[model samples]
Target: MPIVHHRKPSLLSFPMWLGTRVLLRPTLSLWPLNKAGMAGLFLIDRAFAAGPKPSGVVRERMTLDGRPVELIMPSGPSRRDSETAILYLHGGAFVVCGLGSHRSMASRLSKETGLPVFSLEYRQLPQFGVGTSVADAVGAYRELVGERGYRRVIVAGDSAGGFLAGKVVEAAAQEGLPRPVAFVGISPMLDLDVGTNPDRSSRSDAYIPQNKVRELTPLLDRGPVPLQGTRRIRELADDAFPPTVVITAEGELLEPDAIALVETLDDADVDAVAHSYSWQVHAFPVLTARHPETLHAIEVTAAFIAQAIREAKDADDRKDQRAG
Candidate 1:
């Protein structure tokens, strides 16, 4: 749960700064995230899909839990196991950036971890709220781990998807479901209350705005939201709350959220790692090779996942031997 540092040389500092600070920040902060905003997000997805795609990955579409699921398989010797998978939740404030914009990152994770990456297309804003999205995410996890028989799947996401990933584990615990092997929040919005705090105005965030908090936060209350009337970090660190690795850009709005998660998990004696990098955009890892920081974050996340799978498999092996 400590802040780790990396010194990899980056060549895209000026370009990334220009992209996030000048282009994404002003537009995302000022844009009215209404129904029309939903359309705008879709347009962004279309533009992103029209661009170049990641190579050496096999993409397939399917339905899990009756919702859309994009399974990205890395077509290389890197794929070592099909018994485990990575259930990735994309971060787009729970409104935009679906399978299209995030497939590259999912592919990167698949390649790095040697696990098939299932990018879930959960319900989002405009037509759906955060609660509905939570329902979809939790349902998808249940389907994968319960029905699909993937005992060591990793739940990971960025931005709002990170938010959903957290809710999924909490609900899984409450519902008597087996917990995920681990959790990874890539600059996730873990606390919905972070949207309401006026003190955050002094924080140096790249794109997300303070005004947009209350606008979407209310949506969290509209669906079958679990763990009511409590801070998420207050319970179940060693139980349903598994080991975690959360990544954030230094001074971004959600950096505190990442730190609070790692700290609480650490205090509970849960294995947790929080890394904050300087001079990077919010959720830069989603850019997938857009920055050296991004690659480092993904590499760390992938390493965490591989380790979790190893431990889980070993534990299962031990249990089987004892039963025999």
Candidate 2:
């Protein structure tokens, strides 16, 4: 998501901050980000400045769902004209994070999939709330397909972004817009009841506190542009969703969401897959590529997306052959 950067060391009180850090540091190592924990999560993002441009790639500004958005187009004669694109949602607990912090991840996926990626900067909590974010996310997809002539696109996100991906796809299915070819969720947060899933409540979850659900509830409820009682409905019905993939670390607190998602996909008869990295932490896929875990996660992500792309192409080809 959006990243805000600052050079100042003491953004707030040193004693209280140090106390918080001391308490949270052990848990921080369990997550991909060590310095920020969750509090400073939005600090790392600095705006992306246009630099020496790539020869064939095109970058432009556009508006989606009334919100300003970005589209990254690949250039090169050898690059295949993409029949598919990705509309990405970034996760920051519906509060922090945005397109800036997520740009690197988006760019890597674009390169790997050889397809343009659209990363939406949707409304966030304490301002726009969950419903607005989901609306904008779904809106981006519909606009892309209906107005922009993209036939097939995938909806993907990580952590909280993954939750939004599921919500948007569900909305699309209900609205009868052509459903995305596949859905990929990384360490998703589903089922608002903090106690509903024990896997998510375990002490070993390390990074995310056990009370995160309680903390997030008021934010999603009374916050600006709140969910307005639809949160439970979304959580319950999202199981019978669509062709999907749910990826998470087995060690993560959210593993149950992944399992529950698999069960939901099965109920819907959607072609689906769930892959859990054995010893991985949350959002391990977005780290520097030099780390072995990061490299492996990226490779796995690329392979999964490529497979989905190929399968989607095959289905279209078969349909064309029959029509011909």
Candidate 3:
């Protein structure tokens, strides 16, 4: 008999869907506006974010290579002998959002994984560009893995932060730094050239306007030409990348980017997997309260991290046995 797979229904039911369409989508539609307009929207988000914060974690403020970062630790007992840690990068279109705004997600991740999460507050555009953000992220990774003696690191990020996570790994490969054991990209904005496809504009999530890609392209571009022309993952060697998980929402505009990234990684012979939701919002895993799909995604991510670390250790044990 042929195998039959049964997929679970989404938690993004009628009420949440209606709320996204009515309130969230309209607010995100203003992302492509002028600086003052964007600032106003950001301020509004900040104002509304004054509610109770997530608990079950301890937050420690610190500076890594001059950039501010928060180290989040699960409140209960955790693996003490493991040198593995997670480096989390927050997403804000390379323009907005920061450590404070993304604390809830970071804390939740820490609680679920029972691992320390170092959330980096990388600099953004208008004052910084792709180069600076990548630099900050790489610097933080070095501080944690290189200087701090972390043997295994899982690099994870959301949206624009997802892009940064990939870039940092690629940069580390070029610089001969130790590779991360795994990578988790949540609703990543992988391709800056996504705007070239006019059809994608219509398919984008209601919250993310297609034109916003064009508007932010120039600001994020650091090369002589545009960022669209720059080589992203193609520059890495076949074995340079680690196992990766790319998550996306089918309704999101950047779903194509996530699919393309997974395909690219597969072509390079890297272990890459793509998990998609049929009706969730972009970066749904970062929702303030854990949605059913969000919980499922987080569980998937935690499992991937655990499996990757275990596999690496097993491989090392085999190598040691051979040496002996």
Candidate 4:
């Protein structure tokens, strides 16, 4: 299915839904709080948000072009090999979050995908702009695939990271680098222009403050406000894209982003699918543990990755046979 909707509301998600509506949304809406204050709030939230440290996984610290990256690997036999891996970019609106903040999701993804995951601590706003972040991501991917010789790399991310992931694929294709086998964008912030339009469909989104997002745009990129548009992906040809999957929540602020991206990919004749769930907040897949829907989403993502890898390998095998 191109667009799957799971409208079953989960009681487990109620607290998060309520908290977003009453606490986080209002706090972010307060534009009076300067960048420092907003950043301070994010740091405070990161301090308290502890994710599970699952056992039997190895966490290694490494530096990619002077940027910090955490590599997560499962101890047991996984579906991974020297030629296959995952590169994960963490989401923080191009400001907050890092290896520490997103380690839980990386660990979980490693466990689920049976592949080592390189969680990039890319540069963010106020210090670096959108160009730097994209450069960092593309550089890391080159290191992994070109230098490390990983043949089946999957790029995955959530929120801002999701947007970065999609952009990485586009850039990689344009640069004639080794293409990723697939990509997964979980509630990506695709439309930088959404903040410009006052009549956004998700004005009442429970978690994200639309006005605050607009205010933060100038801080994210140096060259131009709204550095990227949602339709930029449309410029990529069908052959430039790999199988892609986008997961979004029903009432989340960026739901329209997910829809628009999928439609764009479809227009390019790229194999794209989207899953929308009811009563789930933004980045719900990584924000919660043991939520039935969260687990289901992970399973679905894992399956998609696995299928993409298989198809890639099969295509390679066919090419080899033809050459022989």
Candidate 5:
């Protein structure tokens, strides 16, 4: 696993520190993990998302195979990445946060990568578990890369969406779909079993309870795994997966999970890198505000995706030349 450590606890972290540990931690740890609870959060998130959105991006609401999605692109005359696009899945623990909620990050990604970003509003828990959400995501990805005619697609997400991103990479291969050129996960929870195990570096950190995750893992996704005899997500990655970049907040609940996932990808001979900041909250990259570290993470993610696509394109060109 290639781990890059970043130091300096910026003053920006103080608010996140207070928000995560002081506010979010207790609330998340005690909240009822039921439909009503999810609904309440959804309402709250909906209001927040309904507020001011990002500027300089054209956001269009549309549906792909009956799934609601938002297509975000740069406002002015811009050049596309040329047959390459991003299928972005937003993080919200598979419950709250929708297109409006995640529009900022998606729009920023569009601006940064010079590619259209399709932010899918997948089904979530209380009605649909992780399996159903994964199904929706995979279907959207297929539509984009198959009929939609994107030659190279990258699946990227944050938090729970990151988990879905991983699942999309795994399921795409099982369905014989073209492999994504790259995968980007920020504070992704790759393994539901992450909550178990006392060895987790920072199990006590914000927004995720070590014990709660273990108990809630089965409820999150009880459907059959795409791979036979393999129940955990970490077992899904193989050589078929493209290069991956994961950003984790050190001392947060998902840091160890990110480390373990990078290790898994590395062991599978997949190029993987993890960037960690010591003083940040889980999934902070999605903030998309004036945060320095968040901006840095997004920059790194875009660079990785661009480089991966270039390599993939080069390989394709080489093969075509040989065939001709």
Candidate 6:
């Protein structure tokens, strides 16, 4: 996807101020969105759509499968034996968003954790479909972990990308692969079932088209391509997932999915935490550097990932000691 830059004199300060306003007013809590709310969402969507460059070392290219992918590395060296990495997934309702939309956020994540990131520009619905995109993600994971020798990989994403992140971890577990050490989903869309979550109805009031989610269900369930290829991405039970972190707006439509994920993960004995930010937009944490909620969310997420890495190292050392 092409990265679009905006030179408007006010582009930098405008959204920051507006985002603050939205964050502060609890009354804005799923308040009926007027034209202004829609406009703000539209403008922000445009900025993301225009593909703003994120601060980091971005390596973009076509993968062995001919799909375009981007690898984002933090701009510094780490002090430890490099073993941790994140496979980032971008959200656009499984239709619009791409690697570029999430570049800046991923760069910030890499900087905080001192780990490299591979932001997948997977295929989407309508044009290519979910099956193709899922396959591409699994392929990328195998390549990065199996061939490239990256250990302790994490799968991360926002919104629909979060859904894919969960799916990727599930697929990995099913294959009996070393599952990602962690999974972080920001405002994830987990369940494809419509009207399953009551909070969904309020989304239209918050400038999100909740009906669109229902509309997309059939197409999503249809296995966008042939079943043989699509079936590669498995739907795992709770046990077939890794430790997960979910961040979401308190009143957003997908809150139900997030809740269900936590319940399922808990039942399966997976470590999972879902942080709720009050009066925020969907996947609001991605705007972290400017937004406090986002910044806090990232801090929490980074801490989780770092702790997981430490625990894994400790366990390995214990195993070595026992063997020795």
Query: Which model scores highest in lDDT?
Result: 5
Cα RMSD, model 4: 2.7
lDDT (0 to 1) per candidate: 0.78, 0.64, 0.74, 0.78, 0.80, 0.66
Candidate No. with top TM-score: 5
List clashing residue pairs in candidate 3: none
Error of 5 at 176 (Å): 1.6
- What are the runs in model 4 whose C-alpha is more than 4 Å off? 31-35, 38-52, 223-231, 234-239
Assess candidate 6 and give its lDDT: 0.66
Per-residue lDDT of 26 in model 2: 52
Clashing pairs for predicted structure model 1, backbone only: none
Tens digits of per-residue lDDT for model 6 on 164-213?
A: 77667766766777888888888877765533445456432233455555
Tell me the lDDT of candidate 2: 0.64
Residue lDDT tens for model 4, 36-88:
66456466336634645667799889976667888899986655577899999
Per-residue lDDT of 213-310 in model 5, one digit per residue for the tens?
A: 76567677644423232335567766777899999888888787777777878888888899998778888877646699988988998898889998
| Tens digits of per-residue lDDT for model 3, 177-284 | 878889888888776566556757635474676776766776676533223223354344255688888777766888776776677778877777788776667787
**RMSD vs true structure, all candidates:** 2.4, 8.7, 3.6, 2.7, 2.3, 8.6
Listed in order, each prediction's TM-score against the native is: 0.91, 0.77, 0.87, 0.91, 0.92, 0.77
TM-score, candidate 2, is 0.77
What tens digits encode model 2's per-residue C-alpha lDDT throughout 1-324? 011111232222234334433565355435432223444555544433332233445666788878767677665554654578888888767767776676667776776677888988888755556777777887898898888888888888887788777777767767888778777776777655543445455454535665655555555543344453334323533444556666666556777666766766566565666666554456656533344544555666667778877877898899999999
Model 6: how far residue 182 lies from native, Å = 0.5
1 versus 3: better lDDT goes to: 1
Residues forming the 10-long window of minimal summed lDDT in candidate 5? 222-231
